[model samples]
Target: MKRLRDSWLTFVKKLPRAYSGRPMAFAVLLGLSALNFCSEWPQGIPRPAWIDTYDRILPDSFGSARQLLFDHFQRWFPRVPASQPVIIVAIDDKTLAAAGQWPWPRNRLANLIDAIAAQKPLAIGLDIYMPEADQTSPDKVAGNLPASAAALAAGLRALPSHEAILARSLRAAPSVLGAAASAHATADTSTDLRSAPILVHGTDPLESVLRFDYVLASLPELQAAAHGQAMLNVALEQGTVRRVPLIMGLGNKLVPGMPVEMLRVATASPLVEVFAYPSGVQAVGVADVQVPTQPNGEIWLHFASIRATQNRYVSAVDVMQRKAGAERMRNKLVLVGLTGTGLTDIRATPLGELVPGIEVQAQVIETIFDGRFLQRPAWLKLGESLFIIAFGMLIIWYVPRTDSRLAVFIRAVPKSSAILGIALNLLLLLSCVLVFRYFGLLIDAASIFIIESVVMGSFFSTALLEDEAQKRQDAAREQVRNSGKTGAGKVFDGALARWKRIHRSSK
Candidate 1:
């Protein structure tokens, strides 16, 4: 019985240390970080999550330091921008009131073309679609009118053959009219191209995000009427238009985008260079010249203030009513769009709220002209993953081993965990800011930090608990042995006195 009891006590004494808590702690930490990672994961994230947030906040803390590191990386590993070429001519509210009501008469548009032709821009782009005949000029539609509908049809006839008329007018001028083409779509495909055409298999800034369809409306008659065809589609994601399409694959046909079409006609170059990478692509000037780069083929838009004097605006009504001449539009891009109170053509962006369509075009122009690019290369991702994993493992080993009594006694495991978390976060923040500000590359860094912190912290916590448990067991065993020795001496002395008294009485 004594031997059995001794064996049981020995087993109990060793139990805590035998649990092997460090590996389990590592696993728990790793799992926790993963959970945090998925919870905060953003949609359309192109790079590592850590890098994305780092780009936003690093500038706040250590301004230029962040950018320096980023540039260092970009200089070593380069990426190409998208090559699709296009430009936007927004038909905004100022032009609408100036031009006269929503959907102005066809003849006024004809005059605008005649004026544009005089400037001889490579090719004029039309975003407005004229699919049906005008309802106010039936005589014109029937080919029985000698004059324009605006002069004769007060409210009696619908204008017939407006698309054909516009086609005729544009054909006669030095401009091109854009169209919408529906191609290679299944029954379940969502037809949400709005007024723009649809094309499948488009490119985006990153593989993780969705790409917009680059579709162009095709009409042989209209095609022949103009110098060239360009896709008139602008891509919008999460209620914001960020990317400018350079190339779009439609019906197994790689079509030239708005920018591409514009550059082709402007330069008359047979082959324009198309840049490709994670963020987006851009069409460069030509092969001989150094190719340019841009993030999502986007640039800063310089708005012509509505309050400006001569640059303010020219109303379509003024042109129609002979109040304004064609000279105002000479050698300039004229965008006509509606800005009526009820007619909402607003889109959200990183800049501000309630941005107009024409401004979007302006931004595109700024991006192309300025050559500001942002992106990360494929190798950067692999580098980030490896770095994060190693950082996490280091935290797991070092944190528990730290001899900071205050950390263990006061803040406990939470403090150590926090330290690990902050370290990982700082590394990510620095990486993103450095790349974006200096190198002009936008890499995601947030994802890596979150994942590493949890993975490493978990290992530390488990090891800490086990170590504490073993120490407690040793202390308990020491107290038990001391108490047993003290009690044994008192019991033995009392038993000897009683035995001597009993023997004296028997004698």
Candidate 2:
């Protein structure tokens, strides 16, 4: 075992040690920055999961961390409540208990719409879709009955379909049906399902817009009767709703989101205007409201505080029962969607709240009405990338000089000096919060500082370890030489002593 240990150490000593120099470290930062910048696609195309995973380990300011950073700021400081009256009519536990099971006969839903419309709301948005017919209708229920009930089944079929009833209510009200986008879906054969006309201001952005193969629109009868249709499919990042695409592609057709369509219905705008270039979409205009968005046709969602949200909802049962008065919904955009237990319409928000999907739509409406938006335009992303790269290069140039002046030959940095890096990271995070709070500009400086700091620390740490190894080798060689000289002196002295003894004996 001892021989093996010595042999291993000797073999390792003979091997050459590569330097973790400034240039090598610089390459790491540059690669990380490039990977981050490339991962961004303003056209709403999906990137692979691993790309995001790696960026979390080593980040550029403009990559995955940007959203998380903004989320953190939002958590720390509550946004000012919006003055726009956007109310969500929630179909919660209480409503379900009163309304019986889901897929409730379409007649009940039609009644809900008529009741809300009677309140004279600005617009009515339905967050649910009926891709299939109501199986609970009278004809369908009687079809399964025994043959003896043939007369009963015939009578049931003769009655008006639950679908026609719903269609009538939709036509009477200013209603927008919410549809979901999918890669595999067959849209209903209703041309009325189409979005308002989209007018492009710049080069064609069709190729760059976020795309789905098709949409799961409402039933043909309902679609024909509804005033408008909007895609409820929003852009999700890390299971959270941060940005919402104002417009998205449905196969060859373009559709607006639920909130924007509600605005169109409310304002009676027949056209939606888009400003986009080959790079990406910039802003979307409908009616008199213009909203800034990310390159991918998405606008950042500024959520309302929980306290304020408390007043935004009225029980679905209350609306249906007429217990909640028209004053609650008058002149307001009312969004209707299910939020009951066993329902799948829940969504996560950056505020760390799990809210019904309908609430998300309502917030978007409020954001549009407030006319305050979070803008992280393409140029800002570029600026952030350039700034990080430049700062890293400056540090690469300056760190060594400063370090060398402080230490003899740029020795391993003292542990205490790490405090400065931590401080810098904290300060950057604080600055990002402030910028978002006051200027509505998001800057993820922490990602840049973290990436640079890690590279900087790694370079110095490797140097320190290798320098220690070198010192050990030199000390071992010096000891070996001194021991050999001492042994040689002993041998010479012994030989002289033996010669003197022999000479004295002979005399």
Candidate 3:
């Protein structure tokens, strides 16, 4: 037992000393790297209060720069030249002017649906919600009539109302109506509504989605007539809509987003399948089309910014008037929504443009069809953490050693370490941008960049302080040697030496 203890003690003594004995510059760099890593450790990890400041600040500050780089890449890259399979029927100023004011009579909208359906489009998604019956309907008009007109009112009320007319159109066509999911819950208002079945193919699907308690659904009459219903609510992060949710959980039921619902209806898929792993939702599949998404069943939309003159928008009036060619509409999914400024449906995108909400959904559908999705895989965080650790250690070891040698060889060379470190960090950032542009991979390197800067700053500061101390020591030694040649000088030197010894002892 004594021999084993002695051997262990000898091995422990041979091990390298702790960080306390290392140069202050290296120690500071090491400490800074650790702090940075802890701040960036995956969101799943529990963190201290101080780390939350970094968590909040880094993303808010760096996210804009990342978005700017993404926009630059988008502008430079050659976009896919194929025809877009999705078309947006925008209710713009022209449409509103031609078809009368906002909320045109439901009977007129019924006629519009019939005209678009004649083009043999795959499906139509109504981004507008009709939560109440048309006020101009015969029933409403009859109720407002006086007794003197009762006989005439009776005949008019007997005719099918405008609500009934629109319902008939919805039943006749492939249509998915929009509903909204709200954060606030109301009383049992959804009792009359029937939610679509959400099937989880794997275990623990509930944890993989964003949950809402209340759904502001379409009118019951419209819901009953539509082929499918979906939530039109967008999920925003920091007030920006960079991603669109494919699925969401409302009460105990999982519901499809508007675009996904339209796709399902067009494909005749009965059930929307949400594939899950222990971590979170892996993908969402409608019929044969499978879409990769983040854990919350949301996709990072690679927005194809359609400018004002981009011909992607077919004015709703043209569609209603049958002025749009059948060749342009055939087999394409149509999204009907308002793009007029009065509607306030505009959303901010990474492209720095405020586009209509329907355009965002249209882009998501386009992304799925083109198989070009922006993804940050589950493994990327781990890979980034390892990268930071490896590079940080290299700087801590390399900088101090190289600074001294470079200083001796050429004084100007030592100053270049800061520039070199910054350049390397910029290169890493550019690589991230390139990977995102060409490969659609998002790797965050902000934390790593910050740590490298700190390391380089520490190196320069430590070198300067050490250099100054060495010059002071050399001057003091020279004065002591000169003092030995004279009596009065020797007395002054003895006093100085005593004071220096006392200072050293005190330290």
Candidate 4:
């Protein structure tokens, strides 16, 4: 055993210690290994198992390597087209202030509908839910209007409750109304008062997020009105509205989406395709199709400014009075919803804070019309995990073996510091101009930055200490040789040259 140990040590010493390159190679391998291992993590990020916890963290800005890769994948994939048949007529702040406070008389809304119907739009979507009878019904209450506006007073007396009046006007025109579902219902609430969603059979988390709770429009009434009804749920993750689900899962079954299915039914296209998995769901035109097995199956919204549509802004009072022109509203999508400040249907978005509920629906319509859906695949996660691990491993292998501290220092500098790095970042920025740029796809450059900085710093530190010691040794040797006057000059020069060569080769 002693002899074998001696032989092993001798063999190790004899082997040229010039394997400085092996450390770098080993680091590259290590980084690759880490990336491969991280690929298996569910959802691409480290998430808690509970739903509530996940929701709390969802809105957080902490992005992962996997998220970055997914963004890249989307850039490469083909975006579908948008074909929304609905329009939004926001009851904006101007109209709200002009029309009076909450629950502007039913007659006023009736007048607005009368004017909107004149446009002959494809259909109208009412985002407001009228769950109860209005207090200002002409027959139920009287003398609410000022005598000066009595000409408008005469019209108010004949109008029905807002629900009945809107229902009547909707029935008269070729339009669709909104409806809510009881997915969030509890036995504590009255079932009669609560509306049920147009549920299929199965219940899914993604579907729940996508389904909307339409107010007054019920299955029977919504079915009886205009042409069809849509599920009005907006899918929001992390308080951010990203994608609109194309299909909704209710209870224990799968059903066509409110807007998506409505358009499909109206267009007389094939059945609505269902694209669902553990990650998310997508719906395609029911012919030969592709599945979106990405993180969240949402499509990009193709927005049209709400103010752009003409005759689109008739006040309720103007519409009822028939004082507004109808020519501008022809062949447009009509969505009626409350844009009042007092109303609670507001959400925070990147573009603006406290955006109206109608705007949310408008976003949905935009995505539907554009057909540019966001998808994530398992491969994206796989790729990201591999990147992280591989990067980490590379640092471990490369820094220590390098004799040329300067080379390590060059690698330590971030890739973005140079003109090439800056140009690369600029190219990414330009990609957004030529195409769509998703911020989520950015790499964790800082992490790599940290690794390189530490590795390079350690190498330089070692080189500095060794250089000082060598200088001191040369000084001492020269003094001793000068005093003794022997063959020390040749030996010392040879040793120093060999040391420099070793350092150069290591680098």
Candidate 5:
């Protein structure tokens, strides 16, 4: 009875820990994922450094391989050309060389507007801003003159004010002035900007569109003169402009973006309509054009790989000098903005090209008009999360179920765990690629792949450590049994061991 009790105790001691470390490791992974997910909500994010390093080294959340695949798909398929009915009145190197530097006298801009207006363009998008009275206006210059030069000051005041000249030019053309959206506490909101009428359908999308605290509108004279005004606020991710908002909110009023305003004026769209589903903002409708957007009212830009502004640009100087013919602007929407190196409006696009900001605005209009979109529904993320959970549980189960001590030592080259991880992710990637090829739906596969790979790797380590512990336990059990053996039993045990060795060798 004593011997039997000792043997039972030894057997119980040799047993492995309950469920090994799988539950612990899996719980920890889940907790970390939960913490990372807080950023998606209103709560603050504890963006851990290790996760960031991993994302950067392999696949960043911002730069999912899906984007690369989608961009290339757009390239290979060639659905629509990047051409639009837009002419960029670029204040480029040539324009600056011909007409001096940026912030040129308002009279010069007025002349440029007059020249463009004479072409009978459908609508002009003036991407420049004149927030304050022109310093170079004749009347203002006159006020700055010394008292001794009273006659010169009086003569200067007699000429028409530069503001009047520009305002009159704006009144002549159906021009949409660009205003800067500001968040600074002291931002200018003295001149009330004309808000785009947003008619909400389902849920109120007042909270969905991008919001700015204040707007730096053009002077009251120019503001009242232009046919329309659009906010020049652009959102960027890591210096790249991949998405653009169609409409935004300034204080309590809704504002149209540069491209949307240009389209609105061109199509004579009286009001912008917002379709808000239970999920979020679905689409923004104006005139006959229906634009699908993300929940936040931004569209994933479908930028085609074409020659950088091959024939899109007409120099500002050319327009001002009448060198660019009226035919260049006839029936076309003209976008005017500075692209001089001194003016900082350059941005990177996914096509690996750095383009002027105005070109991006023009492309937004082109994409909306053409209906070429790369849609990634927000629910797809929920799908990915569900997939990761199910797949991770499978990895946890399979990693240790068939594992054995002997197999651990004689493990196949490129460990079985690694093989499983690669094969499964590759198959998933193939599926995602196919979905993108045919449907134009950009499903993000990188983040899910990273998550599952990390989870499996952790479980793999736990499995190895459990195998090692089990091996040690077996050795201890064998030692206890061998120690209890008497002379005859010990001889029998040695003979059995020799026989086992001979049998193993035979195998």
Candidate 6:
């Protein structure tokens, strides 16, 4: 037992001294890399503010650069022509100009639906919400009338309400109404208004889905009449819409989003299936279409360019006036929403354009059909941390050991202390870009570059300080040796030896 204790103590004592000089710097690099790995822990310690800022700025800035490259690729690459039959029926300035003004009466909307239904569209999703009864209805108007107008008011009330007309139209066609999920709770807890059943394939599925305390759904009459209702809310990051959720949780029930609901109706799938794992919801399947999403069931949309002459849009006025050709509208999923400036539905996309919110939804559906959604693999973070550690150690090992002559040769053109370091980092960045371009994978190498640069800089600074200290020590030793050979040094040395002998005798 004593021997074992002594051995343990010896190991602990030797641990610190084991790392010295270049090895000590390498040890510090490994320690920093370990911290980097811990920073990514799911329920780990909170990172410092500067680290958080570094993470936020570096990746987003690099992402913007990558987005530009992707834009150029889209322009130059030979992409498979998109053939998904999805169209946005935008209520733009032209549409509003031709179809009266904003908030056209529900009856007129009903007329529009009737026209679209005649074309046999696979599904009609109303991105616009009718939360309350239309104010222009006869009942609302008759209430403020004079008592003497009772007969006239009663006659007006006998006519069908606009809500009823729109509801009836919804029942006649394959329609899905838009609803929104709220972070705050409301007094209403009616579960009967839910439109779809959420099926869980794994344990604790609700924990992984985005939970909402309240839902602002369509009126009961409209919701009941429609084939299904889907949430219109989208997830935003830094006040910008980057990802769209496919499923949301209200209490224990999971609800579909507009695009997913539209796909359900189009595919004639009776139920939307959500697959879950211990981590979170994995993928959502609607009939034959399976969409893999983030743990929260949101997809990072790979946006395609919107061309003016493309079949991406058909003006609402054209649809209403029966001007849209049958060949274009038939068997297509149509999203109806306002795109006029004052509508406030504009969203900033990764493609660096402001498009209608409904257009974002259309893009998501198109991405799914095209099977070209961008994905960051689950193993990427682990792979990146390991790479940073290995590469950082390599830099620490290479920078100080690099021959001065070789460094001078490399620095001949640029004349920088970190010429090799800069070249290696650029190489790392280029490799990342190539991976993204070829494999559609987004690996964040910014952190690795930052770590390597810091480590290499420290290594060189230490080497420089050590060199200066060695020169000072060498100069002091040479001065002592010269004084020893001089006459004044010999006399002083003899006197010092006599004083040392007397002091030793007194002790």
Against the true structure, whose TM-score is highest? Answer: 2
- Candidate 6: which pairs clash? none
Give the TM-score (vs. native) of candidate 3: 0.81
lDDT by residue for model 4 (384-498), tens: 4565456545544544544556346556776523544356446644553243434323233433433344444444444565577679899999898777855787788789999
CA displacement after TM-score superposition, residue 94 of candidate 4 (Å): 4.3
Question: Residue 485 in candidate 1 has what lDDT?
Answer: 74
**Candidate 2 Cα outliers beyond 4 Å, as residue runs:** 1-20, 41-66, 136-158, 186-192, 402-416, 484-507
Tens digits of lDDT, candidate 3, 233-272:
7767556677788998877778899878888889988878
**Residue 466's lDDT in candidate 5:** 73
The best-first sequence of candidates by TM-score reads: 2, 3, 5, 6, 1, 4
lDDT of 4 at 6: 100
Query: lDDT of each structure?
Result: 0.49, 0.79, 0.75, 0.50, 0.75, 0.74
TM-score of 5: 0.80
lDDT of 1: 0.49
Best by lDDT: 2
Deviation (Å) of 208 in candidate 2: 1.3
Q: Rank the candidates by lDDT, best first.
A: 2, 3, 5, 6, 4, 1
lDDT of 5 by residue, 185-282 (tens): 45446435865577888987667678887778888888888889898777786677777887787777777888878877888788778787755678
What is the total number of backbone clashes in candidate 6?
0
- For model 5, the local distance difference test gives 0.75
Per-residue alpha-carbon lDDT of model 1 for 61-108, expressed as tens digits? 322333333334444433232321222333446666566666666666
Tens-digit per-residue lDDT, 1-507, candidate 2: 999999999865543233335666687778877765765632343456776776677554454566777787778765676585788888888999998868678999999999999999989999998988888787888888899999999888888889988999999999999888877644453333556788888867777678877677888778889999898987788788888889998767667888878888999899888888767787888888888777678888878766677788888899989999759999989998888898846788888988888888888887787766877776776777888788888767666564465444334555545666777778877777788888888776756766688667756765676799889989999898767777778798799999999999999
TM-score per model over all chains? 0.59, 0.83, 0.81, 0.58, 0.80, 0.79
Show where candidate 4 strays beyond 4 Å: 1-61, 64-87, 97-100, 105-108, 137-162, 179-226, 237-239, 255-258, 265-271, 276-280, 286-297, 300-325, 352-354, 371-378, 390-507
Candidate with better lDDT, 1 vs 6: 6
